[model samples]
Target: MAEVRTKSGEPAKTAETKRPKRADALRNIEAIIDAATRMLAVDADASLNDIAKGAGVGRITLYGHFDSRAALLRAVADRAIAQSDRQLATLDLEGDPRAALARLLEASWELTHRYGALVIAASQALSPEQLQRVHDEPAARVRALLERGRAAGAFRDDTPIEWQVTVIQAILHGASTAVYRGEIAAEDAPGLVRDTALAALR
Candidate 1:
């Protein structure tokens, strides 16, 4: 996400007199995003008008915020990814490597399952490169964690990090699909993925 910042490297402050309007705009944006996320999860083809109504905003307001359906969908995807990034950032990255991997997997597993519908829908509607970008940062973090594990002799060193990252992510995505399809119950998914991924790493 682009930060609205000044040359002094601080977040650009809203004027005192305009703060209320700024707050309203932020609230509307959040409302739109929240409403759209729920709507798209239920029906991938949900209309913009429906989203606007759900958000208690008008069509013009929605359009003013997102401009187009594709843009809104991309924002949905980006917001989800950004949220996970923020939550994952709070985890201890310097702890025991295996424990760190478990922490990461559990966090990712839940997110993948929760956002399964949105992820599937967005991938189909958005550009290929945009979808790839959504996956890239998580994959990089996974790669770094695996490297740490390998260094600690907690995971196999022979396997390439790239392949490990790919397979781990593939497994998480597959587990998420299983949850959405009712093949694996949602509550059971994280543990299943955690164990399977640990086996692969070990």
Candidate 2:
């Protein structure tokens, strides 16, 4: 996604600051976030009113949880990453480096495809710095795996580990774009991403 600078304006409440205290309020917050995720996944330009309606809540209720569209998008992106990280954590990443990498790529491709549109929306709504911070954990997971692979001589070490990580991310993003454009079938993406990334690493 292209880096889109966040506009300067009055500082809005952070997600933490606006977090709900009561059980019912928390439920409402969860509903709004769920609605936002589903809506934004289809349309990056999905409006706050639409999201609120989808959540079965009113605009005032949505605003009570999220101060603005950007704030809501950030929450949606954060939720997606959290869910992705949880699912990825369950994978057995403990075999030959190449095999482990393939497993990771397959799981990563699923998450990337699921969150592709939300990523685009966040790119438009969040600052570069915010986006980087949001992605840090997921990127670190890949970087650590690459470091292990390179140390084992399964992946190339001639290039920096960071560069290799970037290549992997780029390939996954490209696969997402290709599927979206009908250039490739969604069901075929995991194997394609795995083979393509492994070849590039080698």
Candidate 3:
């Protein structure tokens, strides 16, 4: 086995040798993204200054990572998609397709509720083209779940997959808004969304 040496002249472990830590700017970007997500959860209208304050960085530094609020939102969307991708990967769809569909909806509603303002800001403020990669592409995972349910005869044969996608995605969006506005409890939203999806699939 070849022993790797670090810049410090010490033996480099396998993990560290294989994948180095994130660059300074990348770490800062991730910190800012996390701060922005927290701020958005509390204040959907949080400004760049607000996010900067949350991250304990100057507005200029925040801008260095993201040129504009829309740009920041896009980055945030990418982060969300990355996290969501992990969860989607581990899901087992072998059970009842309707139950699986319900689980999918519940998971989406939970994610939306947890990241409500970020979703709202990204959808409304960021250009669709900018969010296409993260926002649009990741939705294909959800569509796959719906397709599986359809193939299993759990979903209505007449229902279009895209229609189901649109409906479920739209409801989750609405549920997020409702949670942000305090019009509905976040805990209740998932159950309601699951019920609605079950009804629609019938």
Candidate 4:
């Protein structure tokens, strides 16, 4: 007869030792992330312990999943980025590149208005390499749209692609600041973005 002994100090294989259902684990992860988001929305300085409590999970459970506050914030930023990605994916850029660039700016302005602080925090916290991984790919897609516009002669042929991208990004930051400072009307955002982008092209 073979000896019946557990390996190391752990219990032997048993039905109870099996992993939780995948859906259940996912639910926990989502719940924790949601809790963190809610906390951050009201106060970006909310404590992790409080967040875990709000999520109805123990501190250990939170750590088991995220390991650190930065990791948790990265997860939250990824969620926000996913939302922006969906919004950007639907833009129609076919007929004219300049018009398309204007439309993209308007779309981006709205997204930044909705999640500016979250985006700013991510930019401030992440290392350059990590930030590039999340932000650069989407940025490149936007740059390609500009390139398309330049090719169509919607923008000045002499304008560098990089300069156009930089100007658009700068305008977005300025718009967000203006909105936060109550210096710009949200209703005027579309026209303002269009005018600013066109001015850059000229």
Lowest-scoring 10 consecutive residues by lDDT in candidate 3? Answer: 1-10
Which is better, 3 or 4, measured by TM-score?
A: 3
Q: Work out candidate 3's RMSD over C-alphas.
A: 6.7
Model 2 C-alpha lDDT per residue in residues 75-95, reported as the tens digit of each score = 788778778879999988887
**Full-model lDDT, candidate 4:** 0.73
Give the Cα error of residue 27 in candidate 3, in Å.
3.1
TM-score, model 4 to reference = 0.75
Give per-residue lDDT, candidate 4, residue 59. Answer: 92
Query: Which parts of model 4 have CA positions greater than 4 angstroms off?
Result: 1-22, 38-42, 53-60
TM-score of 3: 0.75
What lDDT does each candidate get? 0.82, 0.83, 0.73, 0.73
Scored by Cα lDDT, where does model 3 land? 0.73
Q: Model 1 over residues 1-202: C-alpha lDDT tens digits?
A: 1211222254447366556765677788789989989988878889999999999999998887777787788888888877878887787777898888888999888777767688777786668886776788789889889887898899998978899998999999999778767898878888888899989988
> Model 3, range 1-202, lDDT digits (tens) per residue?
0111233355456447544533555667778899988888677788999889888888888887688887788778767767776776677656888878777777767676766567666776656674575456547876887787778787886967788778877888888787777998877988888887788778
Query: Quick one: best lDDT, which candidate?
Result: 2
Question: Model 1, residue 76: displacement in angstroms?
Answer: 1.7
Instruction: Mark the regions of model 2 whose C-alpha exceeds 4 Å error after superposition.
Output: 1-21
Clashes of each: 0, 0, 0, 0
